[model samples]
Target: MQKTNNLGSIKRLQREYAAFLKSPPPDMTIYLIESSVYECHFSFKGPSETDFAEGIYHGKFIFPYDYPKNPPEVYFFTPNGRFAINTKICLSITSFHPETWTPVWSISSMLEAIRAFMLTPAAGAVGGLESHSDVKKEFAKKSQYYTCPVCGANHQELKKIFLLENDKKNLTENIEHQLKINTSSTEVTSKLSNYDKTEYKLENVEKDHKIIIEKENNNNQQQDIIKEENDIITQNEINNECKEELLTKIENDEINKETKEKEEEINQEDDVLTILKKRQEAEKEKIKHFLENKEEIKEETERNEKYTVINETINIIFYLSIFLIILMVLNLLKIKIIMYFLN
Candidate 1:
């Protein structure tokens, strides 16, 4: 079911597009590019004797992917005009086209809407009308005479086409209405001039305001980007500092470990020295004891030798005793002589 509807939509678009190509509207020059079927460029002259009369303007009309189902977007190419670029123009027919656009209304009807909409002001619209009466009038003069490059025809062809295609009663009435006109031409012109001046001033002020807003937005975006970049740089610097500190700490730890090991080794050497000093003191005590025992042995051996000699001499000693006593008495007498010798 969906496929069938899709095919139907395709057929309708193709049919509408074919009809438009077969007979394009008069006065407007349309150029269709082969690559994009929905996009077209057009050139048209402003309406005659009016403010936008003589200007040769270029514009673009872009059909959405949906084409005739939705209204095509229209935008002016030239900047030297009252209306802004790509500003949407409102028309009763165009607005209602989505629901009420019949196959019966040809491309010519749409073109008429374009023309009429350009003449009217689109208040509060982006790229809306802003030209002075004098400016529009001057542009209108040139618009009427300019030739459409695509069609190789002038705008007079358009005016003739409009006169022929439009309601005959309105046209005939408009001519008679001109004859019966009561409003002074100068008064209307003066009033139009004032209106144009006011409109132009407001539109120009709006344009300036929009430009300032766009510029401020761009500056804010740039500042945000710069701030982000600065933050990233600051974070990177902090990370680098942390990494450096960690490396230094690691190196210091290694040095401390080496110092600790060396201190431990020195302590072990001091323990070994203390053990050697205790062994040396024990050896010296043993040597001193051996020397004292040898002295005692010599004294005992001398006493034994004196006992044997006394026994052998006992008999002889009896007779010698008396002699010894006399010798002792003589020695006692000689004591005074010994003492003198000693002194």
Candidate 2:
């Protein structure tokens, strides 16, 4: 399992290397160790914009088992007169401080930070050895002709190759940009036609939505009269879920803000998708309950209609029997009166 995890880092390194080749750093050349990828060598040009300008610096990068998570140990191989040769350069991005290391910080990032740090006065610290400015300038002059035995290339040659690759990369980007512009021009007319069709569909959908909303809102209002108590309860649940989501997002935002501030030391990565997934799952359950409550309400409404119909039919029959009785009594009274008159 450990080996597999290490392999993940190695594979990632391989991909980073390929990407570096396509877009190589301006004044840095990195080469792999004999057969071990974990150890690599780099020749960096002293940033021309600084006092160390034009000084070629050779360095070694040694990776631990947990690379990326742990920044590599960087050591200067050449006596650039900045720090003692073969001395490790201590910076925030180095193995000197694992707490600040982040997997997202690649080898190029490390080199860039180191290059910037080299411009600072060394002060003869544990990892930094300060030197005279004139001596450093002389070293810069000498750095131009320095060659690495392992890489078998001089500084200028490496710099030439890097610039060529950079130009090619830039040219490729320009070509891609032009292709996009050309493709967009052709797509413009089609997109305009598509926009018209979509506009028609959008109007239709909006009308449909209004109709559906009106119908549902009307039905729900009527149901409120019938099952006002139950609907109020279910509606509260839905409102609570919405309120909870709103509050949760606000709280998460606060937490994220705090986390960002605090975790700067750790450089932790957050899984935003995971957070969203959890919230979505919770809301789905609430929706399921809401729908279930609606179904129950509908079933109850059907039962109520059936009961009302049966009661109305019984009331109608009772009234008809009472009218027949009253008519019979009146007819009997009329017959008795006629008999009395005859007697």
Candidate 3:
């Protein structure tokens, strides 16, 4: 079973590679690496009108044995500012996000996705860089002459060869398509000529003459009917003009009345808005006054607390002084009593 799957993968890869060579994607070319079907080298020119423009970048793709059942590893060997050199970049189409891979996706689609991703921000994705635009532009200038070490081919030279081959293929296709169209038209013309060679008899000629006479009479009757219709249309047009004038006058009157009503409503709305503004201002002033009064009350309470604390501290100090003098007086009395007893 595994061998069968491997064969299937190789076959699929061979088909895709052949198709890519037959009609390569715009601005890109792929080459098999070391003659291995599972590994390929690709190079593409930068998208026009971008920082990466004027640059050609080279990259490598390594396909797993499971092939389309799994995604390919994508790495850029070129020193493009958007991705690290020789590092596998994280992208939905890359091996980093295999869940998004599908068998329907081809090498062309992968190249398109990579090209589009180059123009986006790095956003901290693995192997992505946020290089300055100036730096990227410098790299773009140098990239034109860059040769891939692995591929051993100049980027611009490869691009030229691819463009030449693609142009030849497209021109051939156009020529073949035109030839097909011409052949079909020639066949149709030959068929029509053969159809026109049918024999006609005298009875057919007589029937054709009768048809012409009947057609001429019908045309004369239609002309007369058309003249009558024109007369009726002119009369209806005159009626419509009068009706239109009356409608215009009525519409003008209604429009003037509507304008007057709209103006009155606008004036009423302006007056209401002014009143609301005045009320808002009054409310704001009230709030401001209340806040000021609250602040003043807070300050007064703070001041009172401070004064009470200072008064308490002073009273305690005065009591301590009086108690110390009483102690001194008692000591002096005791000394005098001793002297008297000794005498």
Candidate 4:
């Protein structure tokens, strides 16, 4: 029966995953642990306007055999200090509140909720850890550089790309705005100009031998207008170039400073394979310890049962011996009374 449940769970997971792949949530990355379909690693961008802002937290989703019927357990692998590292965290979507769980809720929805939940006050749960708000903020700042060996990437890389794209976007917007302003100025200047924009028909002077002179005059006026337009366009180009140069320099300096910090953080990241090995060994050890404890408790229970039986036996024997002695004394007293009466 349990095996059947597991098969159903795997099928459900695959279907849900396909749906997620169609239109994945922004900034939330979840991937399967191929060895264990029930296990999935996830990373998400922290909610803004919170202590966890600008942070990327890595964790896992552990599902049960009866899942979709039951919510998955959520664990945080990264040390945000807001959540205990490698501990099962409590959330509405986790097994902590199974009574409220519903099959209608999907993994994507649950993860979205968990990200938002990070900003709220922590419940005093046994598995979770607590830290000062300032400490959490510090962790948040450092989270960007954290690398996941399994994913082979870090938040810093994403940030770097975003920075470059953002710079280009700003440059484009600025140029567009400046172009609009220039166009408006050109319109206003042309409107208020003393020169008339009236078009002269060359056909009207075709019959006259003075047609050649009129055409030359018209050509000279067109050249002057073209020259003025070229000057405005050249000036706009120069301004854009100067603005881009200054922006690039400032952005480059900031990236350089952060580059050193990211280097140091690179050393802190654990190789996923090594982490898996250690985690497996740790889990085995814990299971062994738990089994040993179970055996000890069973032995203790058996000993207590024997002790209770022995005590009961000893009490019964002692009472029977006392009852016999009382009966013997009473018979002796009866015999004495009978002898005294006969006398």
Candidate 5:
């Protein structure tokens, strides 16, 4: 049963991969590992006008054997300042939240969602970092030259290739369109020239047309060479800029390190003060409880004393009534005796 499930998962992934090739996601490229359909590599540019802008991020997705029923683990190998490098991030669409996973959700949609999520605050999220805007911006700039260990290509090279491929496609389409226009023009010219026929003149005209075509081709080739040279110059400039930035960054990091140590010391002092305040509050609470208990005890003792006094007063009154009754009985007995003697 397990084997069967694995096979099904592979099939599903293959189908998805085919569809992906047919209509790839915009501004991103996904490459499935040659050995396994379960693992995939993806690269994309960071969203523009955001903290992550101008960055090319490389990441991986590891789909589970029971995929579609479970979400894949998402990991970013790039240091984008939003997520930790090579760590599986916790997101609603990731393996951490299987309940939210749906069979309909494809890799493209997940990438889109992740790009959007990148703009959100970290807020102490797992596998997320709360970097300063300046630090993030610096990272974004550095990302262009960053090389992906898995892909074995730097961001700049990857982007250049992507652009080249698009340019080639556009160039092909333009050339085809131009050829059709030239073919129609050739037919029209032939029809017009036929009205003023001369075989020798026609041959000369054809030769002139071939020369023009050759010149155009040479011009195109020269333009291509110039573009390549410009690209090389630009790359050299970028490298120099990166070196300077690295030097400045190193100096800034040293300053930041010192500031961090001072901040940590201040935080430690604040922590101690907080601990002392908590202890004092606890002592106050204990004292308040003791005083409350003492007051209750005092009130209870007074109530007991009042009850004892009332009981004593009732006992004294009862004894006095008994004595009066005894005296009255004795007098009545004496009167009865005297009357008997007189009789």
Candidate 6:
């Protein structure tokens, strides 16, 4: 369950890991954590002709849940001679504003950006040191330190794993020839470019020996890169497996939540139907009682009407008999009074 909750974060980390693994930068190296893609460590060699030449530095990268959409956080484990200690550099891709980050840029590009931007003198920026050019050149000459706080090894020892020496003479000759050709085209002024070239070649006797040494060093470095790449791949596989497991768990949790919601909806529907059925039965019983009472009331009203008609007829007959008796008595009294008057 805990793993499932971290699915999105895991997936995001995996994507970044895959990208870094598939297309690694020549100047920078990375290794994944044992069980997590989101957290990995990286080591970067300073670019040539810079103050950090021959200097090695290490840093950590941490991705958030909404990565790509949001940039990750990057911090140096070792202090850069110019930058502040453990300061977060504001990168276009990994900054608070993601809209400014370009899709074309990759981890290599980010590293390049760091190299380019670290020399700026921005006040609010972290890790910017102001040193003289001569001082910087001196530091660059002897920058190899044996102890790495982050990787726990000397830069040369660590780099020994990926060293590859191509042909040094061929490489230097190619560079010198290109410089001569470029110089000739820029200006036709005095044959100064040709003169300088001849003078350099004559004065430099130990050139061949230096070339051999450089060639050997390059070969060693290339070999180290290959070995480190292999190690990174191995670690990335472990990270991917762990991430897959986490995503699967999350999917299951989502399914369970949906199922619970559906069951609750069904239960509510059942309750509503039950209430409606009860209401219908109660309505039916009330109608039945109303019909029975209406019929009984109608019967009582008919019986009362019949009794009232009979009482009215008996009263009328008794009154008519009393009036006939009074008439007969009055006629007899009148006849007696007239006879007494005549006598």
Each prediction's Cα lDDT score? 0.59, 0.70, 0.77, 0.70, 0.77, 0.63
Choose the strongest candidate by lDDT: 5
Worst 10 contiguous positions by lDDT, candidate 6: 161-170
lDDT of 3: 0.77
Model 3 backbone overlap count: 0
Kindly report which residue stretches of model 1 are placed more than 4 angstroms away from their true locations once superposed: 1-14, 86-106, 140-343
Q: Can you write out model 6's per-residue Cα lDDT over 1-343, one digit (the tens) per residue? A: 2222245655555665567656666656665554344556777676666777666667766765545545677776555556554776665556654778654555566677776766666455544566676765665444455354543445675454334322333455666775576466345434447887667656654755676676577667656655765676687577666645654555566567668878999999999999999999999999998898997988888888888887887788788778877887888888889988999
Which lDDT value does model 2 have at 277? 85
Least lDDT summed over 10 consecutive residues: which range in candidate 4? Answer: 196-205
Collision pairs in model 5: none
lDDT of 5 by residue, 1-343 (tens): 5432265676677667656655666667776554455788888888978988778888899999888778999998878889998788999899888888888999888899999989988888789888899988888888888776664646888677556655656666766776776677677667765545465346658865875786588559657955874785687457545534543454456457668979999999999999999999999999999998998999999999999999999999999999999999999999999999999
Model 2 lDDT per residue over 1-343, tens place: 5442255566566667556644556767576544455677887778766668767788888887677667888888777666667777777777888888888887787788888888777765557877777888888877767787874657776555545545545555755675675566457546667777677556667755765675576556545444643554475457555534543454455456667777874543355666788999999999999898998899999999999999999999999999999999999999999999999
TM-score of 6: 0.45
Better of 1 and 5 by lDDT: 5
What is the lDDT ranking, best to worst? Answer: 5, 3, 4, 2, 6, 1
Stretches > 4 Å off in candidate 3: 1-5, 162-343
Off by over 4 Å in 6: 1-9, 102-104, 133-143, 146-154, 161-343
Count residue pairs with overlapping backbones in model 6. 23
Reference-based TM-score of each model: 0.35, 0.45, 0.47, 0.46, 0.48, 0.45
RMSD of 4: 23.5
Residue 126, model 6: lDDT of: 48
Error of 2 at 72 (Å): 0.8
